[model samples]
Target: MWDKERRSVATVFATHGAASGTFASRLPWLSDHLQLSAGKLGIALLMTSIGAITTMPFAGRAVARFGTGTVARTLICVNVAVLVAAAWMPSLLTLAACTIVMGAVAGTSDMAMNAQGILVEKRLGRSIMSGLHGTWSTGVLVAAMAGSLAAHQHIDARVHFAIAAAVLAVAVTWGTRSFRTTAADVGLAAEKKEDVPLFVIPRGVILLIGLVGFCGIYAEVASQDWSSVYMHRVLHGDEAEAAFTTGMFAFTMAAGRLSGDAVVGRLGAATTVRACGVLGALGGILVIAARSPLPAVAGFMLIGIGVSVVVPLAFAAAGHAGPNPTMGVAGVATIAYGAGMAAPGIIGGVADLTSLRVAFCAVAVLAGMVALGGGLLGRNAPAALHGAEPVRVAEAEVLATEG
Candidate 1:
């Protein structure tokens, strides 16, 4: 069985996932309610990316000052409230405003939870970050399916979102009760003295590791945005077939994440990430050359598995890479999340100029970059620097007793 702190953090991750998934699954209904065109809806959705990108640079400072638990609990409530408000928006302008707040809360909470996960992993003296992320993906899958069913039954968006908000709020309250409330509480007081910039930016080894994760995020976002389009337009697949390919990518990505920790333990983080990058690159090649829907589906699934653990592993690496884990994480995430926002435009623009196939060449090259930068995630620094040195037995005992 999982320990209290670990399970609690996992619940936080799950609820956050559900909150994000709810918006995506119910987007069509929101679009219909607002009477939005494809262009208008696209613009409204872009507000979310803008909000998240702008807010992420400051997330580390928030965590450093307030502690992960406080930041997470506060933001989870704010994020849920924002999502519920979005369900009631009477105009595109109102909904777009809600989305910006929704995105900022969601992104910052994401950073806080992962910071907590790093602490949990350190306490346990093992690799649990991947498993924590796997639970997040699972939460998304479950929530997406439920939202889809609610929409199919013509349930009111207000009712659905309200119910979701109430449930998540209650769950988060219970789950965060065990969270350690300060850096000193977790034996990380020394890390607080390290210089963390007011604005997060990748520098030194952190930049290199962030670049590796950036490639993975770029590929992941590109596939999520384009796999269905590629299936329908390129292979002339029917709607069901196109949806199936997209489903395949999502399913394999989730499955691979669930199993990633064990794989990391066996092969080590560097080798596993390197291999995953190679696999993603191969998958990209197959997608570019694929003439049939079947091949495209296979390729997308490969891409899914290939990129599944990259972000989790990257977060783990960044957590200990500098004197301040929170700022190190913020810096890496700024770069990596930028890739997520950029992938769609870059790929779409390239496809417009040439072809989608040619555009994916960028993804393939980025995947290869993951392999090249994989070595940067090698072993941690010394204990004095908050590296991956084994947690003192006494410190672990103190944590358990305090909980």
Candidate 2:
């Protein structure tokens, strides 16, 4: 029932969403094939994070210079191509280089596609942000499952990713047709120099929204990487049993997002996000206290549902937050992605020093902050932001950090 624009943007979201999980899901095979030690493999994997952190901050300018569809489509091709080739990497160093390239492409594509999602959300005039994000979560689950199947069947990683690449190519060709440029994009590229800002530091409520997203981003990525480890090492779960932890989180996260729009309509984004914070906090605490794999899985389910819609809604707010939607989204995405990339290292370091339980407790504190600071998201959100002549940034976030 979605129109062309909405469907096109949704495809972009799906592709972007699948990139991280697909690559990540293949890690075991890749490491074994390359004979990479744990430490070496970790360093190699860092290439993607480095690429993302380095390139994402600059994506706003590219999105402004080119239409979101143009940027997204171009990057999707690059992403798919890189992913396919990266799987064929014969040496450790080469794989690291391949991963770096994939990271750059995926990072830029993430920003562009999210920008497209904002455009579509504006066109719809309702809270469809959660649904769009749900699509991404679904893609992640699908690709992860596919990777697992391929691994189990002992299929070549090259064959698996090449097939994925071919499908994405088809998706890009069909899916990018209706992702047209928005008015905000035109204004950004137009003659009004005063309307454009030199740097996009989200102002007022937007900054708070970004902060809220920061908490979720950190928790989301860290949990994905560490949950299984905690179950295996901390709770003495077997291999298959520990793996179920990730599945539990993924399934519940997807379900939460699929139901998120209705929840947002009923309770509003502000309230929904606030509630997510409380739930995440409780889940983290539960995980810490859980002595068995089953209770730990249950706790992760709560954590998954709690953080599911937080980042999506935050991106929606940022897209419509400032005078320039692209830049606003860029600012928030940059902050959140950076936090997410660092979270694993921080949490792991804490686990090394103390234990996994202690590291998880820290996440609970951040979630509590999200609940405490929930008021900042919509303090001045006007009735409608989709077609507003000149959009305004969140005033509170900007002023609080003012020089």
State which candidate has the highest lDDT: 1
Candidate 1 local lDDT, 1-403, one digit each (tens): 1387889998998888778666655665676688865445555656666777899999888887777888888999999999999988899899889977876887788888888887767655677787888777666656666765676577887898999999989888887887764455665545553455678878887888888888998888677656755776678875445545655776777787888887776777788888988998889999999999888889888888888888888888898776566777787888886546567557656766777788788878888788887777655522322223444456556657467
lDDT of 2 by residue, 1-403 (tens): 2365677777777777666556655665665678765445555656766777777777777776676778888887888888888778888788878877776777777777787776656545566667878877777667767766776677888898888888877877677787755544322323233444445555566666778888887778767666655776688765445445666776777888988877776766778778988998898889999987888888888888888988777787887775556676778876776556666557656776778899888778877777876665544333332223323434563344232
Each candidate: what lDDT? 0.75, 0.71
Question: What global local distance difference test value does model 2 have?
Answer: 0.71
TM-score of 2: 0.82
Which residue pairs clash within candidate 2? 203-394, 203-398, 204-394, 204-395, 204-396, 204-397, 204-398, 205-394
lDDT of 2 at 207: 66
